[model samples]
Target: MEITDLTPAELRVWRAFPLNEGVDLRESADDDPADGASWGPGRTVRAEVLRALLLDGPTTGGRVPGLKLTGARVTGRLDLMYGTVDPAMRLRSCHFEKPPNLYGAQVRALVLSDSVLPGLTAGTLRVGIVLRMTGCRVTGPVRLAGAQLSGALFLDGAVLGVPGARSGRPPGPEREDSGERPEPALQLNHATVGTDVWAVGLTAHGRVRMDGATVGGLVNLDDAELHDPDGLALEAETLSVGTDLRAARLRARGMVNLSGATIPRRLVLSSARLSTPAGQALRASVSTIGELWLRGTAPVQGAVNLRGAQLDLLEAAPEVWPERVRIDGLTYRRLSPHLPAERRLPLLEREETGHLPYAYEQLATAYRAAGDEVGARTVQLAKLRRHRRTLPPYARLWGYVQDVTVGYGFRPMRAAGWLLVLLLTGTLAFARERPRPLKADEAPDFNPVFYTLDLLLPIIGFGQEAAFAPRGVHQWLAYLLIVTGWILATTTAAGVTRALSRQ
Candidate 1:
């Protein structure tokens, strides 16, 4: 770090560092080092020079020192591993020959916006303030595992990893089979950010790992395109966010897993296009979210798994529902749009796995809590109908009878209506032809109403059934009445018992 080794461009940046003034070395705004790397020594600053300027004190008489350089080409690695840098560093519109090795370094603030670098290796780095990398193009992986940031992490408009030639997609199958396991484009595993992580308009070619990361504020991924066709596009399992995770218009080529996460506020995935054909597109199983908004126009291409999730409110549109869903243990207190049970029942029916009774039960509970007893019954009826499909032939036939007779015990009034119709028919039929007495001396008077009542009520004998005996069709009519009476009594008792047991 001798003074004689400073190039003209480096000397200019060094002199400007004392006054905290940013030195712009570009001749024009279009003078990009990413195009052909033709920047001469006049705009090229060695990484060692910049590193020394950040760590060392200012030269002669000067103001408070800070390294603020723009539109310069940084050559060689800015190896600041395990170093403590107090000044704020801003290297906007710059190009780096190699990734800055800041592993285990503690910095005040770092801004590399609109910069082009091979990559960054800042694992376990500590930042006192914000780390802004907006509008940068990073070719290699940006590993920030276990890093702790006291402020927000701004990555909006940044392009990370080697993006595909076609619309920033991931590498093709041939490139994937090159026998090398690709690293994540943006790795924040186990990182703790005090504030938000704004990643809007980000295009990441590989996986974005934020597993076990804790964000104090919201994490906005709006308009972000993540591509990892061979694996997960974004894996944030067990991620704990204090506020919301807004990802509207996000296009992920692989699975977006948030399993075991806890988002206290909202998790908005509106208009997100997630595709992992024949696999799960979104898995937020066992998570706890306050409000989950899936209401949007885009169609999810794969199954959505919310098994064991607990949500305060689930807001989803009909068009956004995928073909297959796993809601085994999902429990939501409310469903959005205030739709009726009939309309929302289709969501519970979309489970391709075995019939989940818990989902139906949860929906019914939600409806009942909203003071919609009829809607709750409808959901319960639908649950029985779905369960009936899994029964044997005879059981299914019996299920149909139960459904028609009493709505599987959810409609007690239907049983009453059937009883009334049967009672009236019996009264009319027997009154037309009275039966002869079985024993003339002991027989009671022939009373059609009492005789029909005796036939209908199995346990109650009105003494008229014993006294009467009908001939020919009259006998057949009596037999029909007797069987009808018993069947109605049995069904009514069963339905009533079921209804009471549920309560």
Candidate 2:
């Protein structure tokens, strides 16, 4: 073929060449002496044919190599829609100043790595293939919305600069149908990434939304920084990562909502600081996690909400949590009544010793429940005593004492002594009121008091009634005295005999 300026029609014919039949377009180009520009030294003839090659054919064993398009500036969008490359297509160090659209382009083997795509000013750029951009820098925001990736999407050490600059034409705008209002950066949604995905050390000026993304392996965002107010460092919902989701030192101003997500392995968010509201910090709601390990000294100004989350422990072993787990203001109001008496008692005692009056009040209520009125009264008295001691100086004017007089037995000793006196007085009155009866043979003229004394004198002299009688009574008295003298002697003898026997 002669060296000539190829048109779009001629370029299409070159792309339609059969796989087996080879068409070599290498030719020596004569120098344009008038323009003073060399042509054949580093000129690539196959570069012109690449813009027209519709990749609508099968990529069973296809191969394209030695096709250099270094610093190729495409004015309009270059669409490689539904293109298939079976073998490796080498685009080493190729630069795309304009946006090179590769939407739904399937590649069976390796795509070129380390390709630079800067200032890609196109809306809704999608790469639905095994696209690998290892160490590639995207100067502007690039959207890969709804892109299904089978292989790994490695963007390690890629610098994603802010969108607008001094240039009138800025980067591509985000997708409008993505439900996210106009932001100044890239967004990846519903992107199924197979194998390990690494975007470590990738900087994003604006929000980098990856909602509903699923990664097969570990998704690492080791040391990524975001410098915007509404800048979301990561907003992945239902993000399914296989192993670990290590995101250390990830700073975000807005909320990092990983709500309703399932992390099979450990989800480490160590040393990540957020300076937003309590509602906009780290949120993980209703998430099922194996172990959500958080280490390092990460200061969270906002709340770390993990409500309704279930933590599962598979193995039959003890799990330790050394960190201070505080559940402050966690309301379990329905469970308060159902708490056991033994458990509630300790809490009540803790409150009591802490000088909480409510604890003693509740203890009185508990005693009432147990039908212990005395115990309740005792506790109430103790509370009153404590209140008196803690009163202010001005309130201490009324020096009232609660007289707690305790007696060993039932009544006071003075009351018991009065009862005994009443009993003795009643007995004496009954004895004086009763009439004394005279004996059948005794005279009625006899003085009752003198007769009683005379009867007592004879008994004192050992039953000598004859000695105390008158003349015929006096003669009887003399007889009585003689008999009394003899009886006294006999009685004295018997008393001595009884005393000796008792000994």
Candidate 3:
């Protein structure tokens, strides 16, 4: 473990030992081969001496390493386990043969930018400031389970998950498909981050688990490629984010489960390609988020399961959405792309017929909020019909009757139409077979049209029917007309009451 970067006093103290010790020495990068070269032999700082420098402070003859090294080659495992130390340690472009163990350790700020590690196990580690791993590559799993970070955790351009893995080309203008196999990956379960978790251009070969994690800021995974088709590529169950979880152009080969997660802001997943045909591609069940923006360049490949999720806004065209998506109880306050009900209803066009009542309620609620009463009523009625479809034959028949007569109390005009037809039938019947007046003197002023009108008003009456003398079939015909009128009047009254109540 040769510590290449060191100070004058630090070098004197370490000069007594061999160069096999991995030491922490923070200094400037003046030994650049590109700068016409300047060098002594590479320096070595041992772990024991390094700990003394950090924990015990500097000395006159002896010294503590500043723990900042640039372009240093580390030989052995840089173990910092069970040590609660506060020092800004920045290791840049360093190559480590053995993985660093920072378990149960505490740090102020740590940087491992532009480095390559075999693997990193930092479980229960506490970082006060930023824990940056920018442009680094880890061949083995980079486990950060139960870790606590007061600042941000960046993995910009980091390639993690499997050992010796490499990412392919950037996604082109064509569809970015997750059409290949995946490898194993990383876990950050129950980790608490005060700031954001930047993962831009991250290539994780295996699954990434962030279950029960809480992020104070955004978790940006833009242009990330997580490939694990046989299982979940990203599992973020019950995770909480203060800001957005932006994953624009994220390509995942397997499922991305965000079930029961809480995002105070929006979830920007535009241009994301996730495929899990065996089950769901994305699961956000019972999650709470603000806006959900799925409006991207191309349609998503697999189904999105949003069962019982609550969101403020939904930004996506219904027509372009895939048919396999499930959205039961997926509540949203507004629909984006701002189309009218007539046009917006088409977003539900690709939805399945067996959707739950809560699913229709979500749609109806959106319509109602937009002041589209007709659209709301339609959705509600459709919901009832769909419910009826799951019932037995007799119940279905009853539902059909209600639909044709009163639109299940949604279409009052249909009931009125039936009433008109009934009245006309009665009028024609009375005109053809004129009932003679019971007495000869009552025969003179008979008008059949007025007679039909008087008979149809079941709760009201005119004197015309009394003036007529009907016997045999004509009397029976009067009975039939009265019964038909009763049915129409009853159904019409019920329908009107329902419509008023809905309004």
Candidate 4:
């Protein structure tokens, strides 16, 4: 059909392609009635090209085969507004030279796989369709705000040049109720991909804001250089990756805010350097970085804030500490057995510090939690010694003696010293009991004093029974005096020892 015989709908479809079979532009060129209309030079020509292609069927296959527009320069903007291509399409090395409007185009399958849009620019490149660009270059800012991408959006080795001049418009009002307006089920905002989505060297020069984006698959940014001042390199909230978020060497000058993001699988940020400010480096709150493996030291100038985040460190092998440390509210099912002794000590010593007693109590609590009863007791004893001066006189003396005795249980030398004192006292008593040399001729008189001494000796040997032995009439009085002396001497000695220890 000639272009002049076509209707507006047919012309619109025809504008998306070049000249094709069974369509003649020359015949309809002379007397076109729409000439005086608001049509631009490029739009009119593009329409004619698309018309010819629509009338022609696939050269071989039953389906519409892929369209190749390599190195083709169109004078006007190409509008593929809602066009659908049944097969893969390629615009390799094409130069739009003007804004190509693809507002809501739905490329049914792959579109622009490994193509170049160098001089080609666009106000808004709508890639909301299930588009896949394995390696495509965009020379201007591309907007895929509400686009739904099924397969990977591969920007492998693709460089997006600086954005064009800003247009005049009041800034879009910020959403007050951000939560009310649900974050994109999957939003990859301001990301600059230099390599394939799975490439080893993908880089983003501009701000790569994936804020509120949900990724159903792994968002592999391995060896990607992301530079943004606000420092929101990847702002994923409730992001779910099926596998690891492998970002080895994922250098970010801005903050990698994964606040409130959820990763059911591992979040491996090993060797990833985050050079944000002190407090705003890696903010992940109430989120989960499952099995976080941070192997190499990724110097983060900012705090690795994981305020209420839960980290599963079970997979962190003992051979080496993780390259990245999660300082959030971490929960460990079990620590690595091969963890360095130096690393283990700090974790064990993180007791809540405050007053001396409270600090010691916390230490005891931590020790108990770690199944170290002996350590807990040691902490308790240390605390007691530190606060001994504050205790009452009696309590002070008791605490002192207990400290010497019970605390010495673990010290053999101190225990032996106390035992030696007891042994010496027993030996002296035994030696005094041995038959002593007394001048037999000068035998002691059978006086009251002599009888008393005899009775006292037996009582000391066999207890108070001998003291109660029958005497003339004052036997009860004598027995009382003997019993009083024995009780007084034993109690006095004990009191003196306890009192002297305190001094």
Which model scores highest in lDDT?
1
By summed lDDT, the worst window of 10 consecutive residues in model 1 runs over: 167-176
Which parts of model 1 have CA positions greater than 4 angstroms off? 59-62, 165-180, 390-397, 437-450, 459-463
Quote the positional error of residue 28 for candidate 4 in Å: 36
Q: Against the true structure, what is every candidate's RMSD?
A: 3.8, 25.8, 7.6, 14.0
Estimate every model's Cα lDDT from 0 to 1: 0.86, 0.47, 0.73, 0.47
Arrange candidates by lDDT, descending. Answer: 1, 3, 4, 2
TM-score of each: 0.91, 0.49, 0.79, 0.54
Q: Write the per-residue lDDT of candidate 3 for residues 116-155, one digit (tens) a residue.
A: 7777778789999899999887777677889999999999
Count of backbone collisions within predicted model 2: 8
Please tell me which model should have the higher lDDT, number 1 or number 2.
1
Q: What are the per-model numbers of colliding residue pairs? A: 0, 8, 11, 19
**Which segments of model 4 are wrong by more than 4 Å?**
1-61, 73-76, 81-87, 98-103, 113-130, 161-199, 314-328, 334-337, 340-503
TM-score sort, best first: 1, 3, 4, 2
Q: C-alpha displacement of 242 in model 3, angstroms?
A: 1.9
TM-score-superior candidate, 2 or 4 = 4
Tens digits of per-residue lDDT for model 1, 1-503 = 78778888988888888888879988898876585267788888999998898889484564677888889989999999889998899999998998898888999999999999888888889999999999999988787888999999999999997765221212331121244556678889999999999999999998899999999999999999999856589999999998999999899999999999999999998888889877999999999999998877488888899999999999887778788999999989987877788888887778877788888889999998888999999998898899999999999998888888788878878877876776787778777777888998988778888787787778899888888788898778778778877766676777778778879
Report the Cα lDDT for candidate 1.
Answer: 0.86
Record all residue pairs in model 1 with backbone atoms less than 3 Å apart, i.e. clashing: none
lDDT of 2 by residue, 330-359 (tens): 112111122233333333232213445544
